[model samples]
Target: MKLKLIFLLTASILAFTGCNNFETLNTDPARSSETQPEFLLGNAEKRASDLLYDTYFNGRIGMELSQYWMGTDKTSDGRFLFTNDGLWSGMYAGPLMDLQEIQNYYDRHPEETNPNILAVSEILKSWIFHILTDVYVDIPYTQALKGDVIPQPVFDKGKDVYSALLVSLKKQIDVLSNPGTMAIRGDVVANGSAAQWVRIANALRMRIAMRMADAQPAEAKAIIEDAVKNTMVSVAQDAFFPYNVATVTNRFPYNDVDRPLVEFAVTSTLVTYLQSVNDPRLPIFARPDETNGKYIGKVYGTEANAPTMIGLSKPGVMAYSGSAKGYMITYAEVAFLKAEAAARGMAVGSASAEELYKEAVTASMTQWGVTDAKVVATYLEGVPYKGGTWKNVIGTQKWLALYMQGIQSWMERLRLDPKKPNGEVLFIPPASGSLDPEVTDVPKRLKYPSSSRAANAINSEQAAKSIGGDTQATKNWWDTL
Candidate 1:
């Protein structure tokens, strides 16, 4: 008993002593205090993919605007009634924030920064900002992502933003050309390959330059000439977000089991056009109607006289296989851009406009798993290039190639034919009866979020005015036509 009492008293004293420095002794060795740029880069990529490939934003809002698909149960988006505030806030607070953090880290620790990683970050940031300015017309670019430093960043003009982005992309191309020793880590899109990043950077520069072709002709011409001299993405090196079937979070948006399948159906406009041209991608794009043994698409945005859902074709099953790749940009699109540049008499190599156009169509067919040469030839013959109508031909083909990639398709429409000239516009507007009285045609840009207006009313109003009242019908700077 006496020995037991002494032992207990000694242990109590030791425990009291240990408590004095318990925090230092109990620290987790594996825990990291610093931000991991690698993990953050992957996260930023995923978030951007999610925003772009999301069922609501890309499908209902963008695809509907481009007339690729129409909402069945929910017709608001199809009617151009969507506010798109969530998309705006999501981009700024989500992926953009993550990317900004990565850049900020590198800027602060210049000694530890890798040129390859920095180049990758800049490329992605440009792409995201490209989408933003294209959608909103003008956004807080210069002072954006500064967190509390500039709470109410003034909205920059779309044209100015484009200029800055082009310069930044040019700088990145140089950085990537002579990459540093540090390897990119946690990369899900390009797998940490600097070669692939270089191609993407060059491709983006060309795309941006081409967008400014009409508005800033001389400058755009110079940029395109330089970009064409550099290496661009090949068909095998196309950028895509690879979704997996392992979990709800990783699965393709269309394949999300939690969401109902009957919310949308393929648009009749797309189905009819494909059928008219006898395009081989039709079957891959949509499934035959259930009641009728035919590919019958639903008329776009018709609520009063809307057809029953029983005989309407839904999007194809292959597209929602739970692992469909979320395409960011494709070789076909780049080829089409080259074709356009050539058509415009810009120096885009020795390939003629006709040859480039055919190549683009072939690339697009191949991308959609339709590589049969005879079928593609037949389709190309049906839609042969017309020198006098190169704009319509290229615009129409590009629109078709960008199916299901709604935002890109819609943006391309604005760029190609903002005025929606008769027989020239690439997109089909909603049925006359279905058209919302508030907007006369398909939306060209999304309005600023209400939250933005409420929180930063001065800046929001200034941006709205800068973009010509922030109405859906307002044209972006790139939509010069």
Candidate 2:
């Protein structure tokens, strides 16, 4: 009891006397610290790439919605069930947060921060927001990623988000054109090449411009003209984001066990269209059925009468492999944008619509390993471009080129072919028996995730109401087709 009293009296005296250095003494010297902004670059890139090509976002949600691949044993996604809201939650909390930190680092350490790195970071952030706004329509934009300062960010209108992104992209494009003293480090996407990022930024501008062309023609025309005048990604300079080897820790999501290709089969919509067009890429895009050694696709959303896994065709060997790269902004996509711009009577340099269309097709063929001149020429001959049917031609061809890129293809589809007054869509709808009566056609936009609603109820409710309800049928601001 005497020792306890002594200890208590000493501790009380120390607490009062040594409180000046308490924080320093209590701080753990071995605790992890924040990395330099450069180190965060690759992490942000990988996270965005994962969101683009991962099993949940791309495989289940994107590919299913775009009708590129359909579930074998599972059909909910193909039937327009977007239960996994990781596309929203994961992005805002994961990559977007990383990017925001990068910007914050620059803001805090302006003298130390490289302007080029900041430019790249802004470009990537814009890219991510572009995806988000397109998918969710009205998402947390202006007030997003503020951490505790604004725990619940108000959602920005989709049009306003697009406009802001375009302005930001234009500013960053100038910065990348004239980079800073420090060379970019840990750049897994472009090998620290500021030039490559310029192309990507311009491509993004073109994509956004095209998406908004129908709704905001004057603004879209200005952006499109500016991007086309600038240097765009060429066929030789395609941005195919790399994936690691076929390891358990690092592999393409389609080949990884978590969301293996075995769970999905080629959709009949894709197979039938490819076959009708005599597309040589059919074999390259889909593997022959294991049962009959024939390329047979499963009808999308055929829950009741879906074929067995071995009875249907899976993704091709190259595509299903672990090393297959994710498409960031392909040359083919850029060429298609140029072609569309030209076809729309917009001034886009010397190339005519037909010439650009052929180039775009060739670029896509080359991307999928079809490089033979004769084969490409033959394929082009099969689908000649017509000015009268330019929209259908470009839309169909772009969809085909964007075979595995689910979200991008879906966006293009929504933009190119708007839902008719009678609720008709140009793209294939899910099988009649498997569709939720509430959603009979292809989804226009993904509903805000339930988690988002739960966390930011008032903001989510307001955004949903502003964008014509939080449902798959609601069209985004850009999808005025």
Candidate 3:
């Protein structure tokens, strides 16, 4: 059944060649339109996870932008020239389209519609849209997924899209909150647990709220307060997609023989911070530098005199292993969100900012296998919250905890220090010399893909104008001081 489902999902995704005609092409007679909701849901989950893992989370640009890893090649991603073609297509043509198909199925067979399936689909849809808007800003939202019905969907403003997504998430939460006779199936991420789905929904809500902190303070505060009251309160509830080496296609993208060894190494920013604090996860995160037998990172974006691969730390097993889980959102991130909210004097939960911050650190350590009680305690004592402003303290630790999840790490860094031309406060290594003179700073957002421009030219142009300009340096609505 699982194999059959995977096949159907793959077939469905392949049927849609372009975003402009996804809906029409997806419903062709040759395609398996009779695919079950469970299968569609499972496929959407896997494809979405893979896109995040392969195209964004583990992608070179994201890692380099977040300063988690540096490219050893002369054409290092540190130069900041990038496009969003893979991401835009993956979300729209794969997960989002599959989700819409599932919705269509339920609509046609209303009696057979499982609330659990529908709710999960909605949650996944919200997640993909969140990534889309956060990365590109002002994307096609309400009118998208209609195919021939609305071939040229107008782009929605980033803030308006965010507002709509929060509402959609709430409706999904309501559906999941109520009991239903049918059980959720084909749930590779959360194992068909409605309770876990609820937690994920709430955790995602908290994330969106935090993103809106500077731009939409009152709304952010209210949403976060409610989210904290209901979200995942511990490490066990993290939403992660587990990969199976047995399934060749499902293996981690970086687990290949050549890529891990040749292309990547840990960045100086990450290694320096971990070493400064005597972080135990250093060994776990990176292999010892081959030449010196000590962990060392290559300077990010430097061209002339960068460290050679042999002298720098390569990604450890956790990063490059086929079995490494694709983390969607984690308990550690939730704790930090609550900590940040508390620091902002928002009513999140009973825990104080210091208390939540400590828990977040512990959760991150525990996730990375630093579980010894005494060791964790000692580490916590060393990094305890001091007196004054909590911004740097929370921001720096959050950056460390969100190592492999580069997309989120980039988003958090932008949120913490939005106005800075260079991320000086967050310790993001600046790009220089090799960087294009036209590119004055690290990109605030990705440019609309060439595919998007060709397929939906008018709408894309409007989107760019709405967000100030279409350039990478153009800041999104939420990325404000």
Best by lDDT: 2
Clashing residue pairs found in predicted model 1: none
Model 2 residue 410 lDDT score: 85
**Candidate 2 lDDT, tens digit per residue, 59-145?**
888888888888876778888766678788889888889888988877877887788888888898999999999988998888999
The C-alpha stretches of model 1 lying farther than 4 A from their native spots are: 1-27, 107-111, 256-260, 304-308, 418-426, 432-438
**What is the TM-score of each predicted model, taking all chains together?**
0.91, 0.91, 0.89
For model 3, the local distance difference test gives: 0.82
C-alpha root-mean-square deviation, each candidate:
3.5, 3.5, 9.5
Better of 2 and 3 by TM-score: 2
Q: What is the C-alpha lDDT profile of model 1 across 1-481, one tens digit per residue?
A: 9999999999999999899979877887789666788888898898998888888898888888888788887787888888456888888998888888887887888887776777788789999999898888889899998867898889999999999999999898888787767798878889998878777877888888888888889998898888877655457878888888887788886774565477778888878877877878889999888887799887787663333567788888766678888887888898999999999999989999999999999998988898889989988988888767788889888988888788988888877762211254334557644355657667878889898898789999988987788788888887876
Quote the positional error of residue 157 for candidate 2 in Å.
0.8
All models: lDDT? Answer: 0.82, 0.83, 0.82
What C-alpha lDDT, on a 0 to 100 scale, does residue 265 get in candidate 1?
A: 85
lDDT of 3 at 250: 83
RMSD of 3: 9.5
Q: Which segments of candidate 2 are over 4 A away from where they belong?
A: 1-32, 256-260, 305-308, 418-426
